[model samples]
Target: MKSAELNYPTQQQELLAIVHALAAFRMYYLDEPPIVETDHKSLEGLFTQKMANRRLARWYDILAEYQPTFPICPERRTASLMH
Candidate 1:
């Protein structure tokens, strides 16, 4: 279950990736909370944001169904590890 979406804001793209991953693997990890690791640290505050934006609100609603723990993955560290 791999995917890519074009022409979205950086935040939206990050959220989309989480949505896709959860949808793809929901059956295996539905009962257990999923650990979502990413370089996007701002995502840690996603649910706390004011949902004035409809798109973000909808995305938040979609995400509320699962228990997700976001672990910060520093971009520099990830890039270095990939080398």
Candidate 2:
């Protein structure tokens, strides 16, 4: 990660990964609603509501095109999930 990107919070990185994946698999996402399964519970709210972080806000705009659904698994908790 570049120095400019090193300061992003955990949630921001998670969202970044999602954005990258969406862009990488644009063809597949274009046809159907992508399901993003993550342990980060906050991501649901991050995308659903307005984001304060400029970086996140930008990624949110990118995500709007995919119209993905975050069905965060109830079984896996963020604290317990290992990086």
Candidate 3:
């Protein structure tokens, strides 16, 4: 399943909401690790960089806590889904 959102000023908020939705899905259905597919490169970059604005930084920490060893693959400008 994929969640696609428009790139608006509230992009960060939208992404966080999507993350929560995915987490809920994981808890209710899939017990195994789930690879969340996102088109937002900044979202992936934020997690990969491991830093962000005050509020986003907190979420980043929480996300990092969940999957302590997830991989961050860099994608080319023309590629969809980094790597």
Candidate 4:
């Protein structure tokens, strides 16, 4: 899905993307801890953020179930691929 199509805030949008991708491929990665690679380094500290809203808190809880690992990748190196 396109980011423009999502009405959520930028941070929420990022989290939603991860959630959607994981849900769509749950069968293939459910049994194993999935490695989530992203150009957005902020995602690596997503759960550590002090969520001021319930929505973000809820999203954090949902993510806890997957036990995902976020590896920091330089955006410039992955810029073209992101497009």
Best by lDDT: 2
For each candidate, give its TM-score against the true structure. 0.79, 0.77, 0.48, 0.78
Candidate 4 is scored at a TM of 0.78
Question: How would you encode candidate 2's per-residue C-alpha lDDT over 1-83 as one tens digit per residue?
Answer: 56766678888877887889899999987678999888778876776676686777788789888899888877546556755
Of 2 and 4, which scores higher on TM-score? Answer: 4
- TM-score winner: 1
Of the two candidates 3 and 4, the one with more favorable TM-score, higher being better, is 4
Q: Number of clashes in model 3?
A: 0
Q: How much RMSD separates candidate 3 from the native structure?
A: 6.4
Q: lDDT tens string, model 4, 1-83? A: 67563877676688888888887887887789889877776675666769878877877776787888888788787987758
Tens-place lDDT per residue, model 1, 1-83, is 23445677677788987888888888978679888888877776776778858878877777778877788888999899889
Count steric clashes of candidate 2: 0
Runs of candidate 4 with Cα error greater than 4 angstroms are: 1-5
| lDDT of each residue in 1-83, candidate 3, tens digit only | 22443343355765577567656765653445555554455665555564546767766665654553333345554285335
After superposition, the stretches of candidate 2 with alpha carbons farther than 4 Å from their true spots are 75-83
The whole-model lDDT of each prediction reads 0.79, 0.79, 0.55, 0.78
Answer with 1 or 4, whichever has the higher lDDT: 1
RMSD of candidate 1 to the truth, in angstroms, is: 3.0
